[model samples]
Target: MRIAVTRPEEDAGPLKARLEALDHEVVMAPLMTITPRASVHIPDLPWQVIAVTSANGIRALPPGHGLTSIRTLTVGPQSLKAATAAGFRAEAQGGDVNGLSAFIRAELTPAAGPILYLSGAETSGDLEGQLGAAGFACHRAVLYDAVPAAGLGPVDALLRRGEIDAVLLYSPRSARIWRQLTEAAGLSAQAGKLRNFCLSTNVASVLPEHWTRLVAESPDEQAMLALLAQKGRSL
Candidate 1:
């Protein structure tokens, strides 16, 4: 199967490798571009933990911020991997913002210190609000921004040629971008023909209603990959 991966370029390599390992031809069609915010600073405070909702947050950390000793809590496996690679003492939640907030509530307390949240300019949900409502001090720093792509010409061409078998959508924003771009390119009908594998129901919700959408049981890449493998076997 030829799979189109629509995650941002910075995060697409691993997913592409995973798809290739499963013996599928991969098409890199990033729907969003990650831009690091200029002059962003990691708050120099006695933080209880460094919380990240995406790997881009960790990647956006400025060099020599002197915060590596702080324990990092990531929203998922990929963010955890990024935190670990950045030489921080890191742990990961099950996945998603709610789980991460719950994990922090369960494991840590506000009395310890404030949580330093490194995040993108646009977030799907209010992680800070959830923790703040629980009497926790959240110092949020907008480290990056995920900007939608202008077009998806490569993917449009592939869809028109009937060469793509599926599309892997990781976020609702990216899925929305794909839907809008495909419509703009006049490939909406062709795009509907391919299987659409989404990381979560929220991600799938924004896609065209008539499109064949398969959502992962869990909102993670592993689960999304499992859906692909299971569906591939069935096909």
Candidate 2:
């Protein structure tokens, strides 16, 4: 089966490699590109814990893995690797920011230590709200910015030719941007032709309204791959 891996480039490596290991032909088409924040600024002092939701945030950290001693809480497995590589002592990893918050609140609670959140410029989940309400002094550091994948001549051509089977969306931003690209490429309003499998319902809901079938995977990438493999077998 031919599967198109559609996360941002920095985040697509593990999933694409895993799919290939499973013997599925994978296409690594990133729907977004992550670049470090040109206006670079990370706090001078370290925090008790650091939160990482995207691998981009990990890769974009300023020179010298500043988060060496900080206990890093990550959102997913792929981010875990990036976080560890960036020198954070990953204490725990969750499926998403919501889950990561839950874990952090449970594990590190009622403490006066500063909690720093490493994220993109635009964040979907309210990590600060959740963590703040739980009594953690959460500070957010925007390490990267996510940009849309424009000039999609190949993806557009593939959809028009009906050669693409499905699209895997890792975030709501990706879903929204890809929907626009698809419509701009004249691929929208074609329901039931290309399946949409998203990381969760929130991601799926952002998809174009014309697509009637959108499958939601569990919050984790392993679960997403499992569900994808299941669908592959069913096909």
Candidate 3:
């Protein structure tokens, strides 16, 4: 199977290696570019906890910020791993923003100071809004920005040649970007011919109804890879 990976290059490395290990041809087609916000400042406050929905948020932290002493909470396995590797005491909830919010509500209270949320410029879920509505003070710091790619690179040729069998879509935004770019490149029909393996239903929902789509059992990379492996065997 020739699979196109649409995640940013930093996040796509492990997925690419995994797909290649499964004997699939992997095409690096990053639909978005991740840029760390250099001018952003971390607020000086008695933060009770740190929250991050994406690993990119953790990576975007300025060098020597010295926030590792604060307890960190992550949205899923990947973010948790990143936080842990960064020398912080971190824990992960179920693979979604709602679950992370629920975990915070259950574990902490408004009396426990504020939560510093490290995040990207645009997010699919409103973590701070959700927590704020629940009487929790959630301070969000935009640490990075994910800019959409204007065109597909190598994947364009593959789609045109009808050589791509599947596309790995990690987020709704990236999925939408892929759809828009392919449509603009006059390769919508070719792209629709391939199966799309999405990390979750939200990601899959962005695709056209006529295209074949497979969603992971859970909204994490491990589950996504498992779904791909299972489907690849049957194909």
Best by lDDT: 3
Give the Å error, residue 104, model 1. 1.3
lDDT of 1 at 78: 92
Candidate structures ordered by TM-score, highest first: 3, 1, 2
Models, CA RMSD each: 1.2, 2.0, 1.2
User: Relative to the true structure, how large is the alpha-carbon lDDT of every model?
Assistant: 0.88, 0.76, 0.90
Q: List the residue pairs that clash in candidate 3.
A: none
**Tens digit of lDDT per residue, candidate 2, span 1-235?**
6666778766777777887888877767787788887767777664887888877878888886556786777887777887777677875466888888888888786574888888888887999889999888888988787887775646666666677777787788877887787777666854236767778888888875567445645687777777777777766
Question: Candidate 3 lDDT, tens digit per residue, 1-235?
Answer: 9889888987888778887887888889999999998878898899999999999999999997889999999998778888999998999985788788888888899898999999999887889998999899999999999999989999888788888899988888999999999999999888887889988899889999898889999888888888887888877
lDDT of 2 at 19: 78
Total clashing pairs for each candidate: 0, 0, 0
Which pairs, if any, clash in model 2? none
> Could you estimate the TM-score for every candidate?
0.96, 0.91, 0.96
